[model samples]
Target: MILTVTLNTALDITYRTAALTPHATNRVAEVTERPGGKGINVARVLAALGHESVVTGFVGGRTGDALRELLAAEGPGGKAAHAAVSDSPVTDALVPIAGTTRRTIAVVDETTGDTTQLNEPGPTVTPAEWAAFLTSYEGLAARADAVALCGSLPPGVHVGAYAELVRLARAAGRPVLLDTSGEPLRRGIAARPDLVKPNADELAQLTGSREPLRATRDARRRGGRAVVASLGAAGLLAATPDGSWRAAPPMAVRGNPTGAGDSAVAGLLSGLVERLPWPERLARAVALSAATVLAPAAGEFDREAYADLLPRVAVTEQSSQPEQESHATRQHR
Candidate 1:
């Protein structure tokens, strides 16, 4: 089983309008909502790939109830309850809090394929709630093949929250993956997670370097056993203890990229659990990310797109020497 921790969960809402203009009222033509936050997105992708996953996070109020309902409704055999079934069922192990879960609104412009996001601050988590979460996490980690700690910390939770989670997972001898940003990421990296996935901007913010390779190495120096930096359309640049590699998509894909990072996380975690080689893991991540862009909605990946992109992605080994940055040690397509 795989355990995914989303400290701050949300009810994601996407509204599509004909066009978006500043200071103008636009009528929405369609609306879609789902259970979201980075970890939740990762779990969904994992489930799609026939992996049993359990999602644990904070939930409260009516919105939280609705989120749970949506999750339950999507369970195996299209069941109406939160009961697990055969194949890749997602089990809901969300911790209840006092405040209501937040809502994230994405306004998509049909004319330009651009998205404007308005996110609400999640409900504050009390000390008691945090304690309960830690206890639950420990138990889940013990049973999980791999654990993922993802997204932001809710209000009232300590900044070292992820750091504590990482420590606990490691103590249990579980391979842990972390995906987040800012101070939370900095502090969590110090706890030495098995892997850390960050985008170009987050890597730049943490290491103060715009260069993906250098920033990835800097991130690893901060205590990540391996670092995978998402470079948007350029694909992934990974620095692992074994070696360094870069995976690029065969062609540029344009669409809603909101959940591309989470899809990449799912790909990497799946590859790790399957014991695939580093280069293959990177290839899978890149393919999944590109497939996600082809999906019509966030948190979904196009199966056909992923299959087609899998073998087309180019994976090239990078020289350990900084001076040989331009040289590809080996290339696989």
Candidate 2:
């Protein structure tokens, strides 16, 4: 089973309207809410792909209750629940806290297909609550085939939270994936996770380089065993010990891209557990990310779109000449 950790879990609210105009009252045509966070989103995608996934994170207050209810409603036997592709179960193991969980708002413009997101700061976690979560995570990590430490750290949580989690997961003999940004990401990578998935902006923040290839390599050097940089419509650029490769969809799919990165993380984690080749894993991730863009809400991918795009994904080996040249230049210097 895969384990996903979302320290700052949220109630994701989406508003759909024909168009959003500045300084004008907008009429919303539709509204949807779901349990959301980087790790939670990953768990949903993994479950949809037929993997048994357990979601453990900090949740509390009314918003937390609602999030859990929504999650349960989509799990087995819930009114809105449906059988997973492989009938795999998604288990919720969220820890409770005194503080209220956060809420994220995504306003989708139907006309331009653009999204404006408003996010609230998560509840501040007490030291005692943080300790409780660690205890829970230790138990979950032991049983998990792979663990994903994802998303932002809530207020009052230590900056090195993910770093600590990575170390714990490693000691437990579980393959771990780290997906986050800013200082948390910097420290987490130093913990040397099995994989790190960072989008273009995050990559730039880490390595101070906007060039995908160079930035990816630099990120790996900082400590990640492997680095997969998501390039949005350009697809994924991956650098691993086995080799390097680039995966892209045949064409871009237009829709909400909110949870696309999380879907890619799900694809990569699933592939890792299944022991698929890097190229195959990259293909899966690319397909899933593109399929996510076609879905109406976050964390839901269009199954038909995924199936149609899987075989068509372009996975090409990248040349290592750039690295070799960099090495040569360093030697001369």
Candidate 3:
């Protein structure tokens, strides 16, 4: 089974309104809540795609209890279970803590199709709780076909948490993917994960370059076995040992972009375990990302949209000659 780790799991709450105006009260038309955080979102997508996925992370308090209830309701004999019994299920293996889990708010403007997100800092994890998590993670990693270490570190958790997890996953001989930002991302990449997925802004922050190609190559040099940078509506730019390629959707998709990256991660991980080619994997990632945008809530995608976009995605090989020349010129100067 694919294993996903979310250190700072959250209850994702979305508010939909006719329009949003500054300094004015807006009338909400709809509200939706779901279990979220990067890894949990990935697990949901993977499970939908017919892969057995286990989620292991930190969860506690009332909010945590609600998240687990919602997650469980998606399984067999639950209110909103999967339509088909053949679909793989998402098993929760989350460790408990004393602190309350966090909640994230996303306000969607139906008129402009824009999302304003308000996120609360997660609960502080005590040393004892952190230790408990490590123990749980070790056992889960051993049995996972692949592992994903994702999202932010909660307050009081060590900055090198993802780095440590990456090492453990590697030692267990499991292919691992790392998706995070800031210092955690810096250290995690150094652990040399099988793959790293960073958005354009995060990539630029890590490499000090706005150019996608340059930033992606630099990220790989820092230690990722492969780097796939998400370019928002432009699709994905992948730099791997075997080769490089750019995958783009047939057209831009308009909707809530939240959890789009997680869907892409799901696509990539699923492809890896299925032993699909890089191009095919890129195509899948691009299609899934676009489809997620079309979905109403986070951590979910429109299945019909995904099927329509899959075959239309364009995957083109990128040349390294220009990057080589650019590096040589910089050295000469």
Candidate 4:
């Protein structure tokens, strides 16, 4: 089973609008809320794809309770709902916390098809609380085939938290995939995760290279055995141990782009565990991402879209880079 870790969990609220103007009041056309985070989103896609995935993370207070309730919900924003439906029915288990969880707001403009986001810092996790999380991780990692350390960390947590998680997953003999940005990605890479999925901006920030290909190359050298760089609607670039390649979607899908990267991570990890070939893996990854774009709801992907796109993804392999140190040198923030 795949295990997903989210440090800064949130009650994600999305409001659709005809248009949004800064410093002006606007009525929302539609509103939806869910238990939201990178890992949680991944688990949803995995479940929809007929895979078993466990989501573990820091959740707290009333917001946390509501988040857990939502995670267990059926219909659209289901997290563990797929498991209960497909496999043996089981309740979603989102661990409780001492501090109140945060809320993430996304304003989706209908006209431009762009989203404006505002994120809270999230609650603080004390030292004792963090230790508790380690214990939880150990238990979860023991049963995890793949563990994903995903998204931004909360306040009062060290930036090296993902690094520690990577080490734990490694010790448990499970391959780990890390997806985060800025300092967390930089620090986590030092621990050498089995795989890492970073978008163009995140890659540029870590490697200090504006050029996307150069940045991905640098990222591969640093610590990732394989680097899967998400390039939005354009496609994905994967640098694996044996070789590197690019997976392009059949078309520039027009829809919501949110949560596409998380879908790609689920696709890659699920493919790896199934022992699928690289071509198939990249194809699945691209399909999942493309499906996510088609999903209008925040953090959700359409299963039918994924199935339709899976066979259409084009995977072309490229030459692997010669052995050398990664040139990624970020001015440490």
Which 10-residue window of candidate 1 scores lowest in summed lDDT? 324-333
For candidate 4, the lDDT comes to 0.83
The TM-score values for the models, in the order shown, are: 0.93, 0.95, 0.95, 0.90
RMSD of 4: 4.0
In the range 171-244, model 4's lDDT, one tens digit per residue, is: 98999999999999999998999999999899988988766666777897789888989988879888887677
Please provide, for model 1 over 1-333, each residue's C-alpha lDDT reduced to its tens digit, 9 standing for 90 to 100.
899999899999889999988898889998877788999889988988899999998999999998898887676776532222234888999999999999999999888888899999999999999999989989999999999999999999999999999999999999999999999999999999999999999999998889788789878989999999999999999999899999999999988788999999999999999999999999999999999998876768888999999999999999889624423422221
Ranking by lDDT: 2, 3, 1, 4
Better of 3 and 4 by TM-score: 3
TM-score sort, best first: 2, 3, 1, 4
Model 3 agreement with the true structure over 1-333: per-residue lDDT tens digits:
999999999998888989988799999898877788999989988988999999988999999999998888776456654332225788999999999999998888888888888998999999999999999999999999999988999999999999999999999999999999999999999999999999999999898889899889889999999999999999999999989999999998887787899999999999999999999999999999999998766557888999999999999999988579768866998
Model with the higher TM-score, candidate 1 or 2: 2
Top-lDDT candidate index? 2
lDDT tens readout by residue for model 2, 1-333: 999999999999889989999899999998888888999989989988889999999999999999998887776556554322234667999999999999999988899988899999999999999999999999999999999998999998999999999999999999999999999999999999999999999999999889898889989999999999999999999999998999999997787787899999999999999999999999999999999998765668989999999999999999999888766765897
